[model samples]
Target chain A: MNDPNFQNDDLLDIHNLKTYFFTREGVVRAVDGVDFKVKVGEIFGLVGESGCGKSVTSLSILRLVNPPGRVVDGSILFQGRNLLELTDAEMRQVRGNRISMIFQQPLPSLDPIRPIGDQIVEALLVHKKMDQRQAWKHAVDLLNLVGIPDASRRSHSYPFELSGGMAQRAMIAIALSCEPELLIADEPTTALDVTIQAQILELLCDLRSRLGMAIILITHDLGVVAEMADWVSVMYAGRVVEEASVNSLFEEPLHPYTRGLIESIPVLDQDRKRLNAIPGVVCDCINMPAGCKFAPRCKVQIEKNMTICNKHEPHLLEVSPNHKVRCWLYEEFSH
Target chain B: MRHTQCNDGQSNLKESTNHILVEIHNLVKYFPVRSGLFQKITAYVKAVDGVSFNIKDGETLGLVGESGCGKTTVGRSILRLTRATSGEILYDGKDILKAKSSDLKSFRRNMQIIFQDPYSSLDPRLQIGESVGLPLYVHGMKNAKQRQEIVVAMLEKVGLKAQHLNHYPYEFSGGQLQRIGIARALTLNPKFIVCDEPVSALDVSIQAQILNLLSDLQEEFGLTYLFIAHNLSVVKHFSDRVAVMYLGKIIELADRDEIYKNHLHPYTQALMSAIPHPNPHRNRQKRIILTGDVPSPLNPPAGCHFHTRCPVVMDVCNQGEPEFKEMSPGHWVACWKVS
Candidate 1:
């Protein structure tokens, strides 16, 4: 079936994507009807707190959702092809060859027993059909591209021997060894120190410009999103509550949840006695509340007495140019 | 060259208020790195290498650095959780490092700590009430009823309800678990607390709540905090003064505003620039991206530990360790080029 929300220019288009975890307790709607699009060469940021389904959505795109956790509905269209329709064998061709992913913790993602060089060579060998010697040389080049000093010497070292920053760089090298069209970096810098994080971010931006690859940068950090993302989608309770250009999202955050999240982060310049914290805890994914999932924790809902927010679910609607919000307040502004 | 002269102004100011609650002088903590079956100590990982700082009464002193930079070690060493190799930790004039077992017990009553990860820190088997009241119980609060009352009150202070007391650690979320951790830390009514990356593991919104809660508690109880975190922005927000550590040593120390406004040390400047500002438009300044990871503490680079990565490195920086001298009234820096 053709997805109504599909766009021809989109490198990755996700429409009504619902990924749920089937547990004995109940179905946990992890990525509950989420929608977003990533244009070619654009850095699309999927930002949210832990358990908000940002990672699940990324996994869904790659069709990496393991059993018990499956994408129940939605079309993940990539370059006119539906990723969900592709069989496991068919999907293998698309995995590392066309799309690649880097995880938060680099050490565990890499094989500790194998030399870093062999791992990158293995990725090249599996996907690129390169000989062992050619793959080894390509691995060294990839390592050098990621700014790993003395690439040849360092490639011989195991994952355990490398520092956090070096390991992350090596992970990036492996992710980019095939020169994939899209790179999904899941909290790539979250595990590193501030200085190292800066270095890694610079490297990613540099790699993007040089490699001309579209990226889906998934992180919990708003700051990282602002620095790197061209467009951003803020996820809450497994849905895109707000989607806009990076500047618009930061300046005029439409959703109350989005506003709270932006205000919650303590910036280096601002000095306030207390941060504007969103009241109440995140709603349970297993037995989610009806209507707006954020209504229970929303200050606007409480103050405005928006009873409809608790009764009817709000649809993501475009309120302005390139800005969309899934909120009852903007229900009137919907097209 | 000794930079003792730099502290003259600080010493005079110290006498006027005499509010220096915790004064760490020449503090050093080294962990032995062993190898082979014999387990002979080959080298020492200089965790807290001759670090010195003063935490005033009723003020939050932020200690920030990358992981493995020994920020946690400093906090742990000060609390005597892990004994310091050598140092003078003066808590209101009495040296805590030299305190006897009896004295240390009393010291424990006055000092408390909140760990980073709420998941592993609290025991899953224990009920929330028992964990919160554990400090009180250990401190000779023999009455279970009184302990329960204190735990309930503390939980309320941290924005948790009385109903939460009966729940296990597994039942609560990360934010709620953090609140329980804070409640436990405050249960003893300690004068000083070490909050080690309390909000780092939490979400942004939850971090705000916990930070506000910490500030409110500080106001109510007049608690002094050594807030240790790697997040520079959070440190700037929550701390009265901040210390930037690199390679097991505090490279810079100054008032929060002073440090943020005019950082003398190159390492400090790089760290400030490294923080990805939430507002993209505001971050037009060219970020000073430092190269390479922090050198291993076991065999740190000779001279200034940061010399290898410093954008403005000099020959002298690689030759000898720079003295941590006060550049301004309250701003202290350890760099040869700063002067």
Candidate 2:
């Protein structure tokens, strides 16, 4: 699967990664047979609706899937080293030092009782052996870098005292305190209003250029993915149904699910009488169907006599140089 | 169904060029903030402060604003779900605010509301059928068998099966639950409905489904909607006219095309540019990112509430609030700069 010319450029690569929750009711395959790669300094968008396993895939990378949920199979290669094979101590060192994550809601992720400044300082102190005074100064600088006004004064305030945008800025400050190589932001601006959301998105793009860090942005909003991501992966059920550059994906989506998703969004400029919404809900994970997960909702499959779609699971095969899709419609095009 | 009689009475109501279903004039709703052990009234939150607009018959009026901007408060206040502090709410030429309890009870049948959070809005204890049919039973639909038949028909109208009637709320998905919510709102054959962020909580695909269903139902029933949402795109698609709200105030109100094409208010412009375009090829617009959070309604800025963050703030803007006046045929803006 490795191309010799572009091998080292890939920062994080996953091969058939599977994360499942073993509950008494049934084994829920959250992230099943997922595969994708993020290049250095590129923004890779992981998008899908709720319960589609986009979040689970990110948690699996950090080895942060809690008990009852486990990474059952597949390898997560980060910087050519398999993360799934790492020891707990090594993984801990890799967490804030190399790859940091920001959550959807920043308030609950932060400590309510502690000052926001102290939280950043604590992250710095734990990861690096630095003096308290120097660490505190660096924390203030980080806060200011994230565009927080009156950083020094605002730092002393508790998480509850800060607004939604301010709290998210604090979260970003903590994530960037270590100057990590990769930042995994899970719906970073979903809680924010549009104005603040744009501000946050701009700040992230600025930080990426200044710090030269790769980003894995996970969101359900396709508009956000289109604006920010260099490459996009459309997830369904628990697997990546399609992967392509942002331009190509939006211009001409190959996978049925990706096409439906893009068509489903209500565009701001266009006065579309009716949005072409995909019928039916996502597949049930515990009792998932045999073949293509999206077959039930695929209008293409229903139109053409694509009986193979239901009988056999399709692999993510390349149709173009950079575009890959997991659908039988492109089977003949795959080279 | 027995409720069909109510529609006959509504149809007799005069329909003319100046036919307005509901008109809100200088509505004010304030919740007092208590303090200390004595629980004295410290100040009022002023959730809905002096806002006025009219919903034309069989037209969808979009009420849009950022969170905590009193959009939801306006919808609730118009329904009298939360008693207004002051101002007149005229429903078909009758002041609902001045209506007696008996009158208000009957008027509620004509006006209904669909809440944002489908999960919390519904009662988990009751069956889905009972939940949808509760309004019918309360508003004098006696005969259990007749109510059940109407409930089944209503559920079918919202794209649910009759078998779903016996199921509990927990048994349905978020999209399905929203459909049930819409079913409940439509069961009364309401002439006007306040869809308060109805599609905000659902997924994108499901949101489109719900929006389509709403449009279809609107055409079928000749319903007037006050569609309240934070997402501008959805509102633009569904509403004939849109009103932009700031902290407890309507900063701009215009026809859908006028608001989108000739947005005059700075706040509205900022909001328009902030929407992330789904197409990547389009050159990104110069976004006006408003700095600072919305001020607390308790001690709101003295003059214009938006002056604190407006890019083109003037001395007069800080000293006095601008009057919301019609600049064009249908466009109304509350900004000194626009004039």
Candidate 3:
């Protein structure tokens, strides 16, 4: 998304965003010093394993962080407006109007008590100035747009009554009811079968092109990111360890964590036995490493015995054009 | 520095004689959907409707299908965990479906299941030790000290320590719990195991670790598996032979390479193409995207079950069921359009 043509079209600019949870035990730095930019109509991939704060970053952007968890520092700039400075009412105007999220589990996120069409109409009525009949008609149209067959008939069904794929489509319909400028899809297809996942991914890409909405796709599956994202930001332990264009990231990943994460997956195209798994478990965030958060499980750091990786944390620096890495190994290239 | 699949997860290594370990013939399991008063049977769910496959000795047979496609039921029926409506499940040349209770216990010891849901599969109230050790106690491993020693040894085999014996299910991560489940399944040294989506619930990093561990254990123990899952890549990377199921029927079955390189069935092609390749260059538009949902199993479309969504459907496909013919040696497909 850093292409010269889109250089001035940064839709969402997040600078040093730090979200922390002050639990009873201690202050958990769930999202510490994260920085990225999502340009207009560009897909920004935020990838990590579970508990890596990918979801938390999305929550922070929506200002959904509740008590005991707060955005402690930094600013989130959306379309020349600093969202952090806005009051709750002002932020509400943006939430679900300008931006919306599609959760992992559609059944739980969707209102089970009411018909899915009503849910979409509710969002429409709130954002779009339309009567109930018009909203209901628009809701059915949204459902049809999301590829739910026989939308008019299916719209009357409750969340639980619909199949997993249909429920996901309904959720997408609701998310699209407002025609959001930015859609944060957090593992939108994780619970779906491969065929259904393909359908949903196709729908997302089609919607992006048609509506020209920027998407922040948060997922653990590299395959999905490879197919969908234009730029990728690989997260490790609440920090963006690497960010690069899709081709550059895959071709020459600089960060050890990013390489390990990519290598660990069993690729469909490749016929290789025994993956290069990142040894040791994900580091405990409460007692995070003093240096690189990924140092303990990092093969390169351990192999080279880079003392700095254990003693001092490294900051993300541009190593190649449009490619940023946070590792001492690439410190020379950064300078 | 991990050579083990525990990094994510393998295929091939079916080198022992092609002796069939377990054989299933016309396996049919139908759950009667009842309604109204007196619990009158309205219609059958047709869960594992007329499905069949053979697992060769020490060879992995991957059973791949979407949810509610009768893959789990097929696994359950073979193990006798759930009784089949009508089928012939032969274990080591003897039909176990006809086995008496006394003899059935022996068959149960020979075959076990590693469930999909790591959390719900194991009893929450029981310590992992007790949960893993329960099978040993059931099979008459009476001495408590001996059971503990065996449990400890098995736990260590799966990369866990003896100290984790007393920890409950809640204390362990998903990968560790799967490991524990594997250890328990292997305690009796079962010749065959049904891995029901064992790695589906875990994270990507942990999934690799568990997969590698499963492969390593299979080689070491010479265990045959009916690996059931919907993840095509995982299945292809695992089983020596892959069987693709659709609407309670095996649409295709072939060697690992044959299935990927030379699949004939339209359904299989759609399925293989649908798997989001890790590489992006293969555009999504190139896939054979099948329209419409999988028809309900309760009343599967007559003729070819996949005809409703087949890209190259024929008039004959809607007339009668296509024979599961041998298109090539060892490669099976059930589609008239394959010709």
What's the count of clashing pairs in each model shown? 0, 0, 9
lDDT of 3 by residue, B90-207 (tens): 9999998899989998998989999998988899999999999999899988999888888898899899999999999998888889999999998877778999999999888888
Off by over 4 Å in 2: A1-7, B2-17
Say which prediction, candidate 2 or candidate 3, comes out ahead on lDDT.
Answer: 2
What fraction of native interface contacts does model 3 preserve? Answer: 0.55
Residue-level error in angstroms, candidate 2, position A38:
0.9
**Over the stretch A71-119, how does candidate 3's per-residue lDDT look in tens digits?**
9999998887888998888888889889999999999999889999999
Decide which is better by lDDT, 1 or 3: 1
> Taking the tens digit of each residue's C-alpha lDDT, what string does model 1 give over B103-134?
99999888999999999999999999999999
How close is every model to the real structure, measured as TM-score?
0.96, 0.97, 0.95
Model 3 chain B poorest ten-residue lDDT run: B1-10
Candidate achieving higher TM-score, 1 or 2: 2
| Chain A fold similarity by TM-score, each prediction | 0.97, 0.97, 0.97
Off by over 4 Å in 1: A1-7, B1-18
Residues A161-259, model 2: lDDT tens digits: 998999999999999999988999999999899889988999999999999999999999999998899999999999899999999999999998999
lDDT, model 2: 0.92
Candidate 2 residue lDDT tens string, B53-107 = 9988888999999999999989998888889999999999999999998999789
